[model samples]
Target: MTTGNSGSPISRYTKDRKVGEGTYAVVYLGKQVNNDRKIAIKEIKTGLFKDGLDMSAIREVKYLQELHHINVIELIDVFTAHNTNNLNLVLEFLPGDLEVLIKNTSVVFKPSDIKSWLLMTLRGIHHCHRNFILHRDLKPNNLLLSPTGELKIADFGLARAMGNPNEDLTSNVVTRWYRAPELLFGAKHYVEAVDMWSIGIIFAELMLRTPYLPGKDDLDQVDVTFRALGTPTEQNWPNVSNLPLYNALKVYPPPSRQELRNRFSAATDTALNLLCSLTELNPGKRCTSTQALLHEYFTESPAPTLPSELPKNDVAGGDSDDDEPENKRRKV
Candidate 1:
């Protein structure tokens, strides 16, 4: 299938089967015709609206085409069908995602495994942030896992470049559970800290095997987040009250070190430190990707597992847990 100029030939890939469908695109599991490399073709329905191409599709192509990193999903090709005129994005086919592994009751997650995943995730986002881009959505589901165990960040539709200081960004981004306190408070002038908060929540999820702050709705999200991390007051978060929606919140005291310890029983002191740094109430105080990568948690005992050695789904001839050390096995 050929298209207008500047398009790759759709005939170069075979659409094996339909895997997923979204509001504007249908994803098909496919492979490259020449090398048989697995790929996912996101067929965008360009004719759906009078606006022509969807904005998300445009953003995905606009950004993914420029990013090239091992931890980021590769945008292999972009082409339009000769007859259908549909915009198709060819992406690396990641068979699993972090959310699937986190939800699977039988699969075990060791501390090293969590560290490894977190490390890879940070590496990926560090690349993005350094490029002045924001991965506005960073839930577990968006972090896809390759067959060889490398974790690659995906779903760039919600992503955008860092805006100017005077620019106002939408606070209505990121999933409710993973949304940062700044976003909840309606801070339009936010930065990379928002993504850090999502990573903190995902880290907690890895430890707890459940969502940390599962707010029912936006209003409830405000209550749920502060209740767990303490209400952001003028002292803890300077200029917090200046935000549009930062009024009349219940004043919950910050949890003590012991309290945090009890909450995350399995986490080491260094791990807890990193979590707190990431989820700090004040956006300015939250750790940057560089600081997080340099944290003691990653360098302390029980080193991060090699990507190839990290735990994965049992769907493909599961690993022999019998030979694993006791410390390496997750205690569920």
Candidate 2:
């Protein structure tokens, strides 16, 4: 909240090096001047747009300022640079992300390891949803990993607080691959179930060690999604035809239980149950974050591996200590 020409809040942190550059901002790896704590500074280019600043940058600042959780990225500081008047957000420095680990074939992912990541993701989103915030974009790349192995959900650019019943929300949110059936069908009014669907896809990705439903484009997304999960119809989805873009879609029979079992061969029955519930075609039927947290999948044998004990991106062997007594396992 401080402003100055030479002495300002921006002077409080040192930008060591530029790590990434996007259309609206440049990310720098730096440290807090006082404590020497590492941080990532996102320098927003204020002059790029005629309107002054990008909405994504505004949303990131607005939402992250209100959210505080171990599994959520912390917005450490916000300030405008002295002369250029450019905005900079100091965020916690996360060295790794889930996408890296998932794409790295050498890093083997155990059932428990997958459970830990999914659990952390759920916890983070649960907090957001409970606060009436929708993290429209929930994917592996947005889920960052701390040095201590904690998974923190990042990227609030596409996020917005849940709107009222009469308010029309945008259906064109969330990444194409992780998008929910409702969003795919162009539903203008959606609930937190959208986030649930993304988490479900992420869960599947973690288990398979690859993207589960890799759709080529928007049209192909619908085809690939339905071809794999089956087409949504009134019978199973209940009034799904009422949606804006529900017409003219190929119908594929829902996968048999055995088919699902075969698809996720290594998953436990409980794990599959949670997955199906989360990915339920109907937003009404999709599992809520609260319900998912309490699902039997978390309580069943082979409890979630401790975050610190989870596999590392650099560790090709992906060894785990699942053999440790369950009683010693503390909830994340």
Per-residue lDDT of model 1, residues 81-183, tens digit only: 7899899989997767898789988898999999999999999999999999999999998998887999999989889998888888999999889999989
Q: What is the C-alpha RMSD of each candidate to the true structure, in Å?
A: 6.0, 7.1
> Clash pairs of candidate 2?
none
In terms of lDDT, model 1 sits at 0.86
Quote the positional error of residue 39 for candidate 1 in Å: 0.5
At residue 58, what lDDT does model 1 achieve? 90
Where does candidate 2 stray beyond 4 Å?
1-7, 315-332
Residue-wise lDDT of candidate 2 within 1-332, one digit each (tens)? 22233566776788876677778888877777777677888988887899989999999999999999999999998998668788888899777788877888888888889989999999999999989999999999899887689999999999999877899999999989999989999999899999999999999998888899999999999999999899988888898999999889998988899999998999999999999999899899888999999999999989889998988764322223122121110111
